[model samples]
Target: MGQVRDQRGDHIRDQSDDQSPDESTRKETSMQDSILQEGINEVIGTTHLNAAPMGIILRGGRHTLALFKRSHTAANIVGDGWFVANLIHDPVIYVESAFGDLPDDAFTTEIIDGTPMHRLAAAEAWVAFRAEVIGESSEAYSILLTPIKEEVLVRSIRPVNRGFNAIIEAAVHATRYIMNHDPELEWLIRHHLALARKCGGEREKEAAGMVERFIGEDSL
Candidate 1:
């Protein structure tokens, strides 16, 4: 057994890296089958129990995370060696989490392989993975995560909603614009906001309003 400290300097028990060779192979196969699409999803980490939107990539049939070096998600995963990847479709979740730490009520915990892990309460599905930081650079770290456990929480089938899609795009741009102050990103945010207002449902409209408040662009 081993232990690591989160960003808050609190000790957390590390999940053992030891795995039977056959067990490792089986888990890898499962990861390739389910995580076929590479896209953005909310990642919940134990460091302050924070949730952040991150991109999950499928490279050579293995799931990988290229995390920013300065992010709380990176710090938490580096220290804990494990985290949960949430498949969520709500624009509210994406917008709220992109801006700041979500309220405590938004999360729930489960014990996976004896280690308690945090996950989004509204995730459509969830996967538990053990991560290894395989590469690093000045700006970010490349991580390889293998699925150890997974479950589907919601099974609803719905048609594609462009309004929801627009809100997601807006949320992504809003987060980047806050950090870099790039004028292009702001323009993109407004463009997406317009799409949301024109095409999105009530929830999407609400999300667009949140994005406006988030970036101090009430003029939208």
Candidate 2:
């Protein structure tokens, strides 16, 4: 039931004592995402979600990093012992791009359950992402991530609160999700993607497939 607010008064995760990035890093990240969003719109013709914002989800133990299939990225990036998650706040999604290289604009603003969420950029995050992924830091890939219903195979969709590890039901946190299906989330998803092309959780699940494949068994 603990909730925190951003400057815009959006309910994000509770503020932790961890040291936050400096102001310069924050501003630069915003600039990057804005520019990226523009490019995405132009390429996709104003409808940005034709492809969900792709992200790298970091995980521990048996699994490693994750991304959407259309992203055209490899799973080997997990070798980069570090992790940089992207937090998105839109009507439907609330994902965290666990790796820095995944792309921005995935972390911008949108109305969700009547609240607004702004963008969160990753500057030093990119540096960290490259170091670990290219560094070949570990065979299993040592990085940080969280747990949720989607786990790591969300692909293209951005994450919510990077610090908030799970997709909590509205009653659990006064946000979204109730009885496993969120009406607002459903509507928002429909808004982003055209149902004609591919639709619904069944399709998303089918697209996501097995997390282990993304983890590295099939090896991208």
Candidate 1 per-residue lDDT over residues 1-220, each given as its tens digit: 0111111111222222333335556554345455336553334333337887765665455666776767777877888888677887787877777766788878888887788888888888888787776666666677767777788889889789889989978876776676567889989999999999999988899999988887785223
lDDT of 2 at 85: 31
How good is model 1 by TM-score?
0.80
Report the C-alpha displacement of residue 109, candidate 2, in angstroms: 32
Predicted structure 2: clash tally: 14
Q: What is the C-alpha lDDT of each candidate?
A: 0.69, 0.24
The TM-score values for the models, in the order shown, are 0.80, 0.20
Backbone clash total for model 1 is 0
Q: Write the per-residue lDDT of candidate 2 for residues 98-189, one digit (tens) a residue.
A: 11122446443333224332223322111112212211121222222221111122236443332222121111221222223456754543
